[model samples]
Target: MTQDTLNILHLGLGSFHRAHQAMYLNRLIEAGETGWQLAGGNLRPDMADTIAALERQHGEYTLETVTPAGERSYERIRSIRRIVPWDAELAGLIALGAEPSTRILSFTVTEAGYYLDERNELDLRYADLASDLAGTSRSTIYGALAVILAERRRRNAGPVTLLSCDNLRANGERFRHGFLAFLRQRGESELLHWVEANTTSPCSMVDRITPRPTPDVAERVKAATGWDDGAAVMGERFTQWVIEDRFCNGRPAWEEVGAEMVASVHPYEEAKIRILNASHSCIAWAGTLVGYRYIHEGALDPEIRRMAHDYVTDDVIPCLTPSPLDLSAYRDTVLDRFSNPHIRDTNQRVAADGFAKIPGFIAPTIRERLADGHGANSVALLPALFFAFLERWHRGELPFEYQDQGMDPDLAHGFFHAADPLLAFCQDLTLWGPLAGDRQLAHAIFGAYARVQHFLGRSPA
Candidate 1:
């Protein structure tokens, strides 16, 4: 594929995008596919270093994959045709989206990056969301897309699909909902009509354990490739992308390159989100409190792994049972993958966006279990661990920084100061969702909190 043949505009050019989606596209290109070269951009400056490094390398990078047996391999990825640098204005990204050839706008802007409420509305409380309300292109996916899609509408660019590659349940539909809500907030009925008419949002489920790059990654890349790669990414050997076979413009024959193009991504999505993703965070938060730096260490610990295993086998599996996938095997595979020593997946990385992770990944099992009149004890343990981790942060005992897009420091501090922090944390509607006000749910969390405290050999707070 030539650079001029770019047909995919990817937003949020970060680690996961580089390792997962871009790698899939590169595989297709290697097999003689055409007309889908990727153009990457970031709305926020958080990855300025990555953007600059990719630009310096002319959009080529290395991918290091480590297997469960500690086997490491490297691949040179050249799927990205160009990267729109982070400037004060988002004009370049808007123009890329407006190009008629750019039939797809895919993104890996994390779960929290969506900035949506429980109602799936655009969250304007964010500064960029507020600024974008005034019609200026800036940061945040909503603001950025509001500007880009408006330009596409004005230019009458051919219909394009907004493929969301985040760890979001109903990701494509969620993005579509947030986009329409943002447009409505902008009060652009004509543009809104254009977007509604021209866009397709197909839900998908993406899985990979691509942790943040460590120094050893660069060293391995240099030794293996005879050159240094600053923007290298390291991921697990196993990867999957189950996309709903619905598209507006057109989609690559991704299935030809190991992606699953299915009629409904619902079953696959539910299993992955509730099982793999939720258990990942459970280990991460629990691992952090136990002074473990990496997820594998926690996965190795008997207490930690038991919490995750029970959470999956006891709670998540029953809720998603009698399905096509083998829930037991999937549960075991996820735990085994989490225990991969070579990956060195950091607790901080997995535990960063707990506020978003809870609603998207953990809470569904709880909600389903509660709705069925079954106790959600196993699932309740996750948030209990997170709240305990938050307490450590509150007391400055946490060795690493805790970054949460939706966390309110004042509200979080109140948890530590409350007469019963576990009950207070359990009652936070934003985290526990529909079960926030349920006393039974609070009671379950209290029991989970006691388990976590017992694991840590600490007195109950």
Candidate 2:
């Protein structure tokens, strides 16, 4: 640690960050790339207890990983050198972002946190987003980054990279646009000018099945590593990060530590988002409807597995053909990752954000297929699965409490209690975009919904 050390100030301090991005930095440091380090924190107090525990341990935590074969391994992750405490004002995070030494400021906020509409514009209907637009708080990503970049500009901090490690397709480009739109709406022309010249948000695709830490994870860590680590996290052995390599400031030697620094992240992201993420939602929704609690159960079930397999094999792979990677192999690998029982990825976790997942993960394939004059029958099952899952939540029958950032309770209830719930769902512009009112889309989804009802042993109403 010296004046020469550079930093990556990360925004989200969740399990995915702890097990994925932070681990990459740790590997680089272990390989003797000592010039770069991580200073991680959160924008909100959602994980105050985890942050406090991380600070107590000086930002060191144990990561437990398991393979599909049931073999387990543990590694001590010491990449996060500083754990910035959460504050309502985000004062400490803003100061770190304004530092020229912080070459890259990355974030892992969930996909729903962006609050972008189908048109890629900022959706101010959200209370947090509206409050941020009114300058009442710095809670959302755009709001937080606006103030950070403004302060950095006032202090004359040099150019830095704004990296996004989320599941959104073309995440970096999408975020850059949404962020600039936020500034334009805020009437910060001078600050926007500085941001346009000073920051680069390169698209990146990150993958790792990092499950929410259960009490068993900590007990296992204590048994295996002899450390009482409250900050311990667990994930699948497979991990990946493909970046667009457009950093404005200098970056770490990440390529030396198994990360792919590509000229473009388009192909990689398309495969990951469509095949892995979309299928993940499909399984989660289908699994939850059929009384399954874990993702592995759905991935292992013959009928549920076929639903996901058919969606990728029938709809997605066709659209993504002529790809750099083997689409079929990639699809199989993703399903195998989901079937790892030790990860215990919950249906509740994966099934929580359908409102966001529909537009982001599932709808693109439907749009492409419909544009090519093909019916979206296979892809329709995904939204149908979601509809059945939503019905359970509406009836207060879900085994666990559902959490959706984009869902409106009254709106969802209206959908279920409407004359035709499926039609009402299809007409939600936020979920389907231009395809919202298409008769073909409606027909396909209705048929799929009936099929879902039969699968769940209930007759369609």
TM-score of each: 0.96, 0.98
Model 1 lDDT per residue over 1-461, tens place: 34357488898887888999999999999999976889888887777777788999999999999899988898999999888887767879888889988889888888888888766677667776787778664677777877788899889887988889988999988888887887788798898898888888889899889888888999999999988787999999999999998888888899999999999999999999988998999999988887889999999988889999999988888888789999999989999999999999999899998888888898888888888999988888998898888888899988788899877788889887889777788788777666787888888888988888888894311
Query: Model 2, range 182-231, lDDT digits (tens) per residue?
Result: 99999999999998998999999999999899999999999998999989
**Which structure among the candidates has the greatest lDDT?**
2
Cα RMSD of all models vs. native, in order, equals: 2.0, 1.7
Residue 167's lDDT within candidate 1 is 88
Which residue runs of candidate 1 sit more than 4 Å off their true CA positions?
Answer: 1-6, 458-461
